[model samples]
Target: MRIAIAGAGLAGLSTAWLLDPLHHTVLFEPQERLGGHSHTVTAEVDGHETPIDLGAQHISPTAFPALANLLDAVGLTQDLIPVPLSTTLQVHDAATGRPEVLLAGPHTADPGWPRTPVLGAAAGSLTALVTRAAEWETRDVSWERSLDELIEPLEVPRDHKDRLLYPLLASFVGCDIAEAREMSARAAMAFVLRVPPASPDTAPLWHNLKNGLGSLTTALAADLHHGEIHPGRGVDHVRRGRDGLDIIDTRGHHHHVDRLVLAIPPGEAARLLEPLAGTSAVCAALGTFDYVDVTVTAHTDPTYLPADRRHWSTNTITVHNGWSETTTWYGPINGAQAFKSWTTHRPQPPREPLADATFRQLRLTPAAIRARDVVGQAQGDGGVHFAGHYLQDIDSQESALLSAIATTQRIAPDSPRLTDMLTRAPHASDPPEKG
Candidate 1:
């Protein structure tokens, strides 16, 4: 099969990687460079070029082994650097205007004092809900309920929910309180449960490529032997024909392929697939997914963090009512206070001024939760498979890779690579126990 993949992000690249050697493949990317959201930006600091990921940053080897396997396949396992296990989380208290610190180590947070009792209760409730939901063969009930709906029924106090529980859940997915609440119960629960509880004995909770995530994409692209990558060539339109599929690029060039894999965002896919045969329902479903613009500013300013250096130990600082910005610790890139501030939901300036460069991304809203089934239905349709972060409610490197694996499995079941990838991939059903 001559497979044509649109969008050269991790999903497109991974799909091409799995399908190549078995089938002739070609990848088209609209941007001049590949690695769409897995981008890494470099800065000259102290006479050294430092790599800071302005896009997808962290990876969990224990939870999402597909990414680890991919790194191994590309000979980049040596570049895997473990993130610091000893960290703190600063939850900004709206009323006091000061941040409350939650000490995190390895697999769990040291829930102290007022937060202890509430945190215990919330964790217990979430575990029960997630466990029960996981056991159910049909998640229709969980899927229909929003995170807010699921948490409202819990017996925790309103204050605790506002301060600790809600913020914790929101921080897990990198969304604000409102956005988290709007998320589907299943989507939120799946993300929350995937995070293994902090364990003192565990080596490290997360890892990142020493060079950057871009290296992974670069390696994947380099390893492709049977595919032609056309960066800066955008697909203008897509329509199915009796012969196969007709793809017209923005350059007025036409390409014919036996199969078409859309590894781009849903909105882009919808625009292209709308004119195709028997795809109106799918296009409509894709159109329903709304997106929020997020701006990530990379800076070295200590003012971006709390006044006390002790609070700076925290990897993530989530503001209770602030939807515009979420702070992330970049672990001292180039001897500077490296951090990325994420502004979500609405257009606004960074909560504080930034001294470094900023990168913007369009992320799916909680509304995408409702369209998950539709995306699956479209992917199941033969010949055309959709792979991207939008397929899953949360957008991350892990989800993007998983989406590609799923698309490859659906479109190329006979490929030995697909079987191997699936065999090595972690089972979503068997989540690790939280401490």
Candidate 2:
């Protein structure tokens, strides 16, 4: 079978890698390079060129079995290095103009971050809610409530919810607290509960590649012997015929294939699928998703962090002000000489004076949340499969990989490698709700 995959992100690459070698596979990417948002760049630090990931970084070794297995298959397991699970969250008090250190621990020690009385009480209430909700989650009935609706019933003080709980949830989706409130309750629960436990003496739970995530893509690309990768080529239109699928590139080159996989964002997918029949429902579903642009800056300045060096853990810092909450998270690179800081904000005009190093990222908004059944309905008819982070309603490396695996299996159900990988992969398990 001749298969054509769109977008050279992790999903597209993984699809090509897992398909049977007998099939003719080709990947079409609009960018000149691969890896989509999993990009890595080099910065000169202390007379040495060190790689820093300007895009997606960090993965949970236990939660993301598909990615772990992929690294093993590609012989890049040696490149995986564990990062400290500890974090130092700075909760900014708007009235006082000072941020309080909620959690502070080095990568090696457990930081018993304390919560305020109100916040602690609120946490207990939320735990009870989740415990009850879990029973509903396993049943046939739907529990598709927004985060805001769930919080509304809780008796916690508004201050605590806005300051602590909301900011924490906002960080999960890379959106403001107000926006996160609109997110599905299930998604917020999944993200928050998946976070590894942190203690002063706990070992690292998250891992990153020694050279950056780009190395994983490079390795996957190299392993594709039977497929062709067309960089700098964008698919302008996709039309399904009686026999096969037809794809037209920006340069007007025509190609035909027996099957097609779209690994790009939903908006772009909606545009391409609009011209094809039996895709209206899927296209309209794609159009329902809302997106925001985020900017991450890498800099040598530690001044942007807290005054005390002891509180400089590579965790998230959340600034709370009612509904408009912003999170600032950092990752140390090149022995702490440089760091990457990410800011999640609503779309707006570009700021004048770019940071020393910056990368712009696109993410989903809360309105995009849908029940799993709704997602199933959006899976367009016959040979056209959709894969990417948005499919899962969350943006993360693990989400993207899992989406790819699911899409691949849907297309090539009989492929042994793909089937075996899925069978052995660990399912996403939620952590015990905190009281």
Candidate 3:
């Protein structure tokens, strides 16, 4: 059977890798290169050329075993290094105009580390909320009900609740916390608590690619046969028939295949497959999932950051915009600070204004942050399948790998070699060709 898989990001490549050989497979990507949001930028540093990641700077050990396994399979595991999480927060006082280094630590006892003192303040309320959220039983009730039940009862400080918790929740849902359902937050809190701090010497518990994250995705793409990949092609439509599928690209080219898999974003899938029945709700839900705009400013010089100061900030930070606010994070990787933010409101034209020198200030404002959720599904029709990092539950390579494994299972049953080798995935019968 000939199969066409759209998008050459990790999910697309993984699906192609898993299904090929057993059946003919061709994967398309609109970008000239693979690895959608996981590409790297090269910079000259200290006389030699070095690369920096503007996307996904860190990986947690707790939630990334599947990602790690994929890296190991592609022979890129050695590129990983344990990064200590050194973070210092300088909270600004609006009225007093003073910056207080509220909390600093790679260690509980490090000099200037205000672990307990800061926690004793209103920050203590955060630990309580986080603790309670994580400890709660997870079941069906919609994420919306869970959040109101959890947060409303907490006696947290008003400013902290507004400035800190709400923003953090926004980042989690990629939408306003009020718009986000509570089930998602509950699931997120559980994931955060599972990973304990790594060590006293190392930064908080996170890992980075010694080279760059692109290594893992690129290596996966490289391992596939050249004939298997078709880059720079955006799939515009999918035609379902009794036999199988006809995937149409943006250029009006159609490729017939016995199986079709969509490895693109959920929103993209929703748009392309809207004609199919049952997909409308998934599409509607997908439209609700927001994505944050990320402007990764790479400071050319590491010296710009004070040496005495710790480079890590909160894994997430919330800042006030003119009326509302957004969330962001900072990480020093490959000798540069990466500032990632997502905004509450979508810009008028959905433009990357950061690419323009005149609109550079937008990158600093809280409103520049983008919505971050990517929803994908098999709800549209039985013939088409959806998968990606966003669809896999979280934004990590492991989730991408899992999505690939799951999508492959849905699209091609009896093709067990890939899953047996890379993932212990469950088997599913490919639906009978739509009649």
Candidate 4:
């Protein structure tokens, strides 16, 4: 049996890794590299060089089972480092230069440095405030609703509303909370709050690879054998064949395979299979999914923002007041003192220069995001299959890998080769709703 897979993103590669050997697998990658959204690019920050992730960064240890397995399989578990979550969020406050820390989750000792003078907020009062924040979160409030309710009454001195709330919301939803869908808001808040409670004494754990995410991709590809990959080939079209699937590449080459895996974005897959014979509602529903653009900035300077150790007057903050195109934040990486920040959730369609510049000031902005439209249509059935996080409720490197592995299991159930590959346990104890 021969299997054909399109796109070499994490999901596509995962599928190939799982199905190969059992079947003669061929992978199509339009790009020269394999990381896809799991990207880390280098940029100069204040004359120093640093590596920053352009796509997915900071994976919570609790949320990614497949990622953990992949890391262990590649013997890169030692490269995983936990990034602490304590920091001071500063906002530009009028009259009062003092910034305040918008602390949530569990109360940590030494709330780092006070962004503004410690409002004399007592321990019990602080706990109650955090509990209230959690309550609003658990109820699945849209960021719009939560921000309106949480920001309006707080008479805290400083630009806390814009500096703290806005950026946090933007990073979560990849769009401004005001414009974000209620469902997206609920999901983001729920995910963030679910992080293991962190105390000043006990550091919160957020893990990432020390050598960069590329290390994981390179390792997986190597284990899978480099011969399976076909670089510089874009999937032009796909159709049902007598045995299974007929894949047409950009170069007009056709290959017959027992199974075809459309691991591209939903939109791209939908377009390719539209000309094919059968289609499913899943594909049509994919057309309705919307996406926002994210711009990434890499810097080596610990000046504007210090390393993970010291708290800045204003380090990571969210802005939602008035009308802003996107939400943004700044953070430090592990093993190095470099700092980087990005603004996400700005529309990606082409826009004017002023708008682009304002957004890019945060290293990422609406203009950079809007320039490229994300494909949302993914449709297929029977002989054909589709994979990627865009069609599902969550999109991330972890999700992509999970989808690929799961899809391959369904396509080739009796493959003995996949037995040695670790089977990942579901992260949530509760079963996920089936689509």
lDDT for position 311 in model 2: 60
lDDT of 4 by residue, 1-435 (tens): 777888887888778777756777888887776767777665554454545555566665467767766666567767665555533433333456333334332213344333322333332333443465687767744333433455346454334444444455455544654543233333344445556545534334566666667777788788774237878888888777786778888888998888788888666776876775546455465455455555544444332232333334222442323223211122323334444444343223222111211111111222212212332232235667777765333556666876776676778776554554554443323212111
User: Ten-residue segment with the worst summed lDDT in candidate 3?
Assistant: 356-365
> After aligning candidate 4 to the native by TM-score, how far in Å is the CA of 356 from where it should be?
15
Summarize candidate 2's per-residue lDDT along 1-435 as a digit string, tens digits.
Answer: 888999989888888888847467889999998998888777765676767776777776676777877777677666766665454556766678677765444455433433121123544554555564464456523335677776666676676566666666666445766777776766666644455446524424566787989999999899877899999998899877778888898879888988888988878988998987777777777877766555666555554456676566665454545323222233432253666655434222223212433333333435465523455665646778788877774567878888887877777777766866766544233222211
In candidate 4 the C-alpha lDDT for residue 290 amounts to 54
Please, what is the whole-model Cα lDDT of each candidate in the order they appear?
0.66, 0.66, 0.54, 0.53
Q: TM-scores of the models, in the given order?
A: 0.80, 0.81, 0.75, 0.71
Candidate 1 local Cα displacement, residue 157, angstroms: 3.7
lDDT of 1 by residue, 285-404 (tens): 898775555566766545445555544532554554544245666543223446666645323445433343333343344556667787787675657889987676466787888888
Best-to-worst ranking by TM-score: 2, 1, 3, 4
Residue-level lDDT tens digits of model 3 in 228-345: 7767788878877668888888778888877677777766767887887666656775555445443444333222122333433434232323112222232333333333333334
Q: Candidate 3: misplaced stretches above 4 Å?
A: 96-99, 105-119, 137-148, 169-183, 188-191, 198-203, 277-282, 301-318, 322-382, 421-435
lDDT at residue 304 of model 4 (Cα atoms)? 27
What's the residue-level lDDT of 214 in candidate 2? 93
Indicate the residue-level lDDT of 209 in model 1: 78
- Output the number of the lDDT-best candidate: 1
RMSD of each: 5.6, 5.5, 8.8, 8.4
